[model samples]
Target chain A: MKMKCRQFFEEFGVTRMIAVGFFLAIAIAVPVLHLNTLTLYSQALTRMAMNGVLVLTMVPIMVCGAGMNFALPIGIICGLIGGLISMNMNLQGFTGFFASILFSLPFSLVMGYLYGLLMNRVKGSEMMIATYVGFAVISAMCIVWLFVPIDNLVLRMQMGRGLRKDVVLTDFWAGILDDLCPVTIGGLTIPLGTFLFLFLMCFLVYLYMHSKTGIMMRAAGQNPGLAAANGINVDRMRIWGITLSTVLGAIGILVYAQSYGFMQFYESPKMMSFSAVAAVLLGGASNKRASIFNVIFGVMVFQGILTLSMPVANVLLPESNISDIVRMIISNGIILYALGKGSGKK
Target chain B: MKTIKQFFSENLVVIFFALLCLGAYLIAGQAPYVVVSDLINRVMRNSILVLALIIPIMAGMGLNFGIVVGAMSAQAAIILITHWRMTGMAGIVVALLVCTVISVICGYLLGMLFNKTRGQEMITGMIAGYFGNGIYLLIFLVLFGTVIPFWDEELSIRSGIGIKDTLKMIDGMKGAMDNVWKLQLSQVLIAVFVLYTLYMAYCIVKRGRENRSAVKISVIKWLIWGAALAAVLLIPSVSAVVTRCKIPMITLFFVILVSVLCQFITSTKLGQDFRSVGMDIGIAEASGINVNRIRILATIFSTVIASWGQLAFLQNMGTFSTYTAQQNVGTFSIAALLVGGASIDKATVRQAFIGVVLFQLLFLLAPSAGTKIFNDTQVGEYFRTVISNGVIAVALVLHALNKNRKKAAQADSI
Candidate 1:
């Protein structure tokens, strides 16, 4: 029993332990400090839904032994393009949201395929190279966003050449999913539509993982040499895994834009990958393996810290934005620990 | 015929770069003086940072992507020194001293972590850089006023809690080193020729002592290199371009000395151990080398040199965007080195120099070239970024592919 407990602790990690402690402490203090518990929990729930899918996007690629998908920005940019084009066409309500999804499909597919090919060529150094690829894509898009000549006046700047840095979605698909079926128990509102969407994704991923192809991907990830010897197309599986992960990333960002009500471009999506990478890692996933449970749990914990630490820190120290500092430290520190641990085991 | 094929295969990337430069020159239609001057200045400024990359590559750490950490440490030290009202060479020296100490500690920890991680060193280094950046920012932004306590309000943000985004070095130690002793183009060329002749003679003597027949071969190789460099210098158009670009002779000397020191160190026992450990850890371990210790030493050397490079870079610029200046040190330098045709397993001082010149020259011309071709300078900006990043990615991909091919060939042989 003692050994089992030690093993559990070893797997659980001290950073997560401290993170859990902070979460619980904040939960208790929210009520004690006369803060709106309902509002805090509600915000946490929304934030979790907002970030959950992006974190989940890591599972397929990680299962294929590609580590975290640092090239998430590529998928994100595709989604942004799709969403902007849909908005430019002035698609509205649920029609606009789904239209954005449909539009992003081809973009995501092509980008994911090319990115996968590049990743395959640079197998061992995927993470590092993926990072630069993402950077290069975003920067290249920076030029594209300026010169693409979109006709929508709202999307473009007043000078009429470049895209605006931030496009308001207030007139578009803002809160389409979140407001679809919100349940308010006291002030603790549950975004039922968002939760349903997340559940649907989770169910699909779970079903896929149980399929023969998914099993092959997992086997390849676990032991590529054995999989190769057994005649599984490991490279093809990895490419597909990257493709699916990227498609999910596109959908994830569309959801983010709908809820957040702003379509930010250029450099906006640059640092989005790090937080999601950290969140999935926080859920006890490593470079080789992750599960749906890890995704849900990681998003909850990661977003909880970002959500609660603010009000709590504000109450505790009203002089500064201590919560932002705490967020940076905890998130980055967790990632650093994960990266170091991942390396150590290998 | 075999030699021709070998040359083409070996230098495909360099050939491509040369073509790219030619194309850029044609598109740019800028004065040669403008391009040459910019290239010279940039080469002098950025070469040291690229040189800092050589040690880690020699030790087979792939690339020191964590050199950004050293740069951050240097920036932090510079900020502190500036705030303390230190000026001129004194301030620069103090900053360098502080950063060196800080970087050694950071590098030791990084090296130890890398040792644990082993094959994941490159990714680990990249992530470690971001992780270190977070902490560095926290300190500079939050702790400087609260815990650390800085007195200079000018350097601090309006909140008095963080460092300003841009810190001017005009009042402190701007161009202190570069201004020490500048040299004319003719004088610099003559000096370089003299040095090269002496070095070649020494090489001939040393090779003659070791293997009598090697003397003639060494002499021939020296003559070839000398001829190529001389050809560039002797052509009137190229000479006009070179002479128009006044050299920072002092800084050039320092860069050369460091490069020589690096070359010399590789001949030492420690450097040999590093080379062995870098080549194959299993074999190196069996051969009784302390692989981890040597790796750690290599990282320490790299990080310290990178710190010095950052100092030199900022001193020459005379100011810095405090938060952003050190961020791309690893990226640009690594890209430059790769562009110069160095791979993950191999790098040299020659590669660093050639890489800096070619890479920065492309950077210099790209904007105008883009403007001329596409009617938008932003295209040039994005093009350069794409090319820089594309080069690194392509190099990494090629290296991995080459490794796999080698492994397959070995399997076939078996």
Candidate 2:
């Protein structure tokens, strides 16, 4: 029994245990301290559904031996472009959201192809290069956002030619998923539509991972040399993984924007990758390995702490804005811990 | 002919930067005097911070993105010094002292962490920097006035719980070193004489014949460099810019001192250990060198020097946004280094200096040039960021390509 306990702690990192404990503490304290635990739970569940696909994007790239897709913003940017254009064409309701997804598909495929080519060239230093590539692309897009000539009154800035920093979608696609069959019990609301969509994605990803192409991807990731010797064409496998990840990333942002009720431009998508990367990591994923279970588990724990910490800290600390600080600490701290764990052995 | 081709290939990035700067200069059409003065001031302001990246690169820890943590240490010190109402040079000294202690501890912890994450040191350091920034923000925004009990009315917000978002350095530490003994040619000559006397005194203490030759060679090199610098200063156009800019003699001297020290350290036993580990860790370990310890030392040295560099930078600027000033330190520094044509696996003091001058020159001119061409100065700002970050990405890609080619060649050889 003692040995089993030790093994449990070893296999599930102490940090993950601490994170679980922290989540449980918040869960218990919310009720014991008479805070509105139901609202917090509802908020966390909504966030988990919203952020699920973004976290899921990391697995395909990781499986193919590409590091975390720090350039996730590129795909996010493609989605933003698609969503904005769809709105500009005056599409509304579910058709508008579907059109946006349709529009983003080509851009996502093209961007993913180029990004995959770039990643292939810089094999050993993919993560580092990906980071700067993300920064470069984001900043370059800032110039585009200003000059791209989108003339929609709702989309453009109030007093300038450039696009507005944020465009509200309340009349269009906002809560398209959330409002569909939302099961409300007293003060708590469950967005069944969003949860179902997220699970569908999770199920599809699981199916793909067990498929022949998926096995080839995993084999290529695990041992590229051996895979190559067995005529696997590792580069093609990795590129496919990247392309799929990018496609999902594009879809992820569309889902996020609908539920978020706004399409944010310029620097909004800049730090989106970090939060997703941290979530997947907190779920027990590493630089070279991850899974769907890790994705779901990580997003819930991460978003739960983010939702609960504000109320909990308000009751405890009261004066300062401790929630934002706690959010920053948790996200950045988890990433640092994840990066450090795979060190020294390689 | 092949040598010429090799030279062109090696310096291709430098040529591109030179041509780009020339184009921007022609487009902006700024007066020579204005451009030169701006360049002089910018170089003096940014050189030390860029120099802070040298040691870690020498030790092969990639770009040292955690230098932002070092900048944060300096900011923490500056905040406290302001709280205590210390003014002038004394304030600067206290801040420097405090920063040194804080940065050494932070650097050691960061170094140990970096040691574990060896091959991916760049990204690891970048993440660690964000993590440190979180803690730094918490301390300043949440704990400083509430838990730590700083009582400066001016530095705190109205709520008395957090430091003000921005603080002015004019009342205390601004240009503290720059204003010290603000020099002329007479001071320069006197400093040169004093340095010569010190060198002579050191020579006498070096009683060994072998030591004498090395000392003599170094002194000769130093004299030649001194002559070249003096000649440059005497140029009429350069002198006009220098005089107009009021370039701080002390700051220039500090830059020179760091350059010399960095060069000297690389010739020492510890430096040898760093180089060996940097080249190949397995071989270094087989040779009985403590690779991890040397890497840590390199990180500590870089972080400490970066803290001092940040102090110099903030003091010169006379004001800073407490939260944002340190955030861009690593990004800007790494971008500048790459712009100078340094690669991920190699860097030098010369590259650091050259990169700073070229990068700052482009930064100084691009906005005006953009306004001239595109009728929008914001384009220039965005362009500079894209160019700098794009340069880093290109350099990384090239390095990766080189590695792949080398591996392929090795396989072919086998």
lDDT of 2 at B177: 73
- Candidate 2 — which pairs collide? none
Residues A1-346 of candidate 2: C-alpha lDDT, one tens digit per residue: 9999999788688777888788889878898879888888898789888988888999899989897889899889888888988998889998999899899999999999889988887888898888888888888998998898775677877775788888999978999998888998987888888889889998998899889999999999988999999999899999999998998898899888888888898877988999999889889898789999899999999888888888988887666777778777888787777777766446
Expressed as tens digits, the lDDT of each residue in B36-106 for candidate 2 is: 76786678778778888888888888889989989999999998888787888788789989999999999
Off by over 4 Å in 1: A27-40, A117-122, A160-162, A226-233, A311-327, B170-172, B198-244, B412-414
RMSD of 2: 4.1
What is the C-alpha lDDT profile of model 1 across B1-414, one tens digit per residue? 999999988877777887898899998999888887777788888988899888888888899888988888888888878878788767877987999999999999989978977877777788788778778777877677778877576787776677787988746478877777787676677777788789878877666687876877767877887787788789998888877778876678778877887778889998898899888999999999989999999998888888888888888898889877987898899999988888999998888877888889889999999889777777788888788777877777777788777878999999
RMSD of each: 3.1, 4.1
Candidate with top DockQ is 2
